[model samples]
Target: MSDLREVAITSDSSGQLWNACVWDPFVGTTLMTYKGGVSNSHCLSFIGRDFLISGDAVKPLLHVWALNRQEQIQVRMVCPGKVGALAISPDGSYCVCGIEEKLHVWQVATGRLMAVIPRHFQRVTCIRFTDDTTHFASASEDGSVIIWPLCKVVSMTQDIFRSISDSAEPRYTFSDHSLAVTNIFIGKGGMRARLVTASLDGTSKIYDLASGIMLLSVVFDVGLTCVTMTIAESRVFLGTIEGKIHPLCLHTPPRSLDYHLTETEKQNVFSEHTKSITCLSVSVDSSMLLSGSLDEQVIIWDVPSMQCLRKLQHKGSITNAFFAIVPMNVFSNNLKPSLVLSSFKRRSDTENEESYCINVLNSERILCDKKSENKESLKYLAGQVLQLKSQVKSLVGANLELYRGLIADVWDGHDDDEPDPSFESTQEVGVHKKRKIKHKKKRNLET
Candidate 1:
């Protein structure tokens, strides 16, 4: 296994052609391109470090690629219908394909069908495995999420005589969303592992997996399409249908029915996308954020600064985007990560039709402490310099006017016209005596 970090992009282009391209971010080059697969679906995932599993919606097949061997292993008839979603177990021993409302579990090593579980009433939108691999979750258009135990599902495949009643029910089923559940993500391993779900009902909810209670429900104005959490899980990054990214702090209580109306909430919004935001991915380190939209743009954001670092263009609307660590030993210094994006080419005649394409973008520069500090310092210094220059110019103008006024007074010979203090006092006394005499004359005339 190579230690090099590579980003794999899967594109569904026009003409029913799918291309999977791998990029080396460190060298800024395309390492490989596997083209001409017949899948318009966005069901691609990395199975361990070597194999890539892709499910085709147009064709009922699963294509597995071994990067080291440069060969593809085809698993035919994986699903009866189109593969709506897919998830691989953390241990990489099993894979699950979501076909409409049913789920098909397959053993990876032997490519044998393990079990078929029919659960959701609507098409499954997303699926994910827990960090421990003991559980997996599926979200559906029915606005519900069900967490299933991996042991029970595997047991059904092994023991035919075992009564179906002996198998336990799902670990938990969350039915809080009113509309289709667009995405679901299990928190990183910890004591407080949580499940976060986004829905078309314009809300995202956080649930405590252990207690099976809703911890927080955040309501937004626009429907949420996707979500990702930070490393600490203290904040959630959400993608909305309005092409906006909203970061909600878990610690803060919801102030109103619409959280976006709050003053504090306004600052965290990233509004670069002109079309609907389709996906969001945060780096493992939690320092960078990647967002892809129907606007055909992938924006790299500095999480702390909330500033866009780079923008990557796509030939079509982006379906999915994520950041992954490159295998370490390939680079002299393993500093930067790679961005993988899956997009589709839009049809001119049919606005609803699109084909997929994959793009692997290289991050030539990584977000660093020194770089952030320097950028801040430069901005601060530049502002101070501009302020000081303005102040100096104003002071010079005021001083110049004062000097001109003083020179005019001195040059006008106004000193000779200055009044004497003694004459001014005598004039005041005479005016007072004249007023008293006028008052006595008026009294005598009345008598």
Candidate 2:
């Protein structure tokens, strides 16, 4: 199996039409483009292999496009204000839109309004669904994050409104951030599921989903705009407002004991962009990183070396970029790694042009070497060490048993009156005792 991956980008700049494209980073070719959707805002989400959902920033309408059929479907919803963020469930059963301080849930199949959650005090910044689709979380400018049960939220009626004193609160609410919460990311399944939240307060916090306790908290000098973790969740990559990418290790604490640590030691700060970094995405294998910035540049970074593998330019500021896998059948005979970038440049009074474009670039060179073989070799060595330890333990036990048997046999044969020969010999080893015994023997012989 190939460890390399391709990316798909969706972006809109004209505020009227959105474009989706797939890029092969290895060959630097545009594999596919689907540009029929209408979106005036930064809302673009891939629903599945066939459909995409986009929302208009200027209106309360959500557009759904079928990539196969080249058809569009519009779903209208009542919102108190403009939609700020949107997220779709993993199973494609529901779509949640964050409009102002409230959240609206819609059934994707039936186009029916499901429920409304009026919780946050400020504008919602981002929403994310868990990997299992059992729950979802939303971050807001109020500096708080709320995890909601999907089942409970879907069962809620449109008329139901949660009050401030309601006993049925959200599953978890994180309020450690002092500024707006910018992004929320949920880790893949395991014994301890983790949720990482980044904020404008210059801090990113990792929380245990089961216990709601923070396991790690890392503070940066600048506000963070986005975050994504590798598949293993051992390291987290953060995009900051200063157009810098920060990678943090979650397994160990920093060497510095200072509470106000400015920068992480030995951390590679990617500073290619001149503007704030808007979004970041990591590959499934965790070997590649994609970052989109307001400077209209999308960078493909080699994760291990922290080197810029490829730099893709855009005409407009980048809205979003993703590191997605392109199916094997999507291209011809050759299968190479790819990257997708979405950029949008708003037109001025004179220029009448579409503001959105999706660029698919094939990687000219390989980004990373596969580390699976190295991991397997380490595992084999560790197993051998364990086996040797067990063998040595067994040998020592057998030798101890034999020594104990010899001692028991000697005790059984000895009489109490005749002191043990070993003990008497040990007592006669001193030079003064030996001389005194010799003199006594000589005196007895003379007599």
Candidate 3:
């Protein structure tokens, strides 16, 4: 099994050549390009590893393409409004879009619109999913960031164009920011991870997602435009409208009473871009940092040295820039990934979802096109496809019931024994879960 290399993925708003391009940062080589998916900031993303999804920059259309393809497929899925930000679950089972003041949730594989949640009073600015894909946080212009459990949000409706009831509130509605929230970044470890959100109010707030408590607040002089952390999250980087990147250490909370990040506290600030920063992402190995700016430059920096390595120039302002793994078989003609199960329908109009679903890829058609590959190659590829599909399906269903029950215990009364909300260690969480299971068994026996 080949462990594929990571590449820098980027896009520009006024791209005439290509909307999305894959580049090898080390050698400064453009490996691939995908056209027709013109999107603004935070609108270009991967729907799992096999598909690329982007919202149109100036229109309300959604464009999707497979890994190897350059143009979008024939399946057209339109949104009611222009998308501001979009995120898909890691398993590719669900997709959520921030369209104006509403958050639209959809079942990706089936192309069914599950719920239209109107939680924010103003337009949503950013949306992010947890590393475990169980919960998602949405930030809006109303100066609020709300964390929502994934399963309950999708369970609000099974029909087309349904509104989420008043009773279905978010898991945690945080109104800590005084101005519009510009960016959101959730750390790893699922609910136990910390949530960092930056706002135009010139502050970055960190919250404990599991306990819904504010851990620390770092105030900056200039308003922040983007935010990201390293793999270990020992430090956080905040991008500003002044075209400077500020870094803060997590351990050095001031000896004084108020824990604040001031001008003197910022040990070193990065000043490379001439315009406001649009997006920032750190490499998986925590050795490099990538930042995109409105000055039409995407600069890669060495994290250890804090020096610029190279720059990727664009004709227009850079919109989206991040790191992604490029699979080894992306350019292989014989082992192309098939996406026949997804429909990408605009809306769910009928009771029987399976009746009108569209099949984008056909096995017979592919076999006819690739006549040079041997039968052994085709057989092995087919087996790999089946195994991957089964694995993805299992991942989507696994831990869903467990997380749903945990969330229900948080909101509703504990009809059953449940773990404490503010868990401190892995050992404590496991012990509490086992106790809950044993208590439930006792209740069943008594009944």
Instruction: For each of the candidates, give the backbone clash count.
Output: 13, 13, 0
Q: Whose TM-score is higher: candidate 1's or candidate 3's?
A: 3
Best-performing candidate as measured by lDDT: 3
Candidate 1, lDDT over the whole model: 0.69
Across 1-447, the per-residue lDDT of candidate 1 in tens digits comes to 345343534343332323454443323355554444543344767765545666664676666655433346443334566777888876667787788898777655544455667778998889888888888889999999998888887664434433232354788888888999998878887324899889999988888888878877787877999999987898899888888898877777645433444666755699889988877877777777888787877777888999887776666666556666544322323323232212111111122324322243435444467878789899999999999999999999999999999999897887657889999999999999999999999999999
TM-score of every candidate relative to the true structure: 0.66, 0.66, 0.75
Tell me the tens digit of each residue's lDDT in model 3 across 312-338.
999889989998777654565544554
Off by over 4 Å in 1: 1-18, 23-31, 38-42, 69-71, 74-78, 157-168, 190-192, 253-264, 327-447
Q: Per-residue lDDT tens digits of candidate 2, residues 304-340?
A: 8888888766656666677776544334344232322
Candidate order by TM-score, decreasing, is 3, 1, 2
Pick the TM-score winner: 3
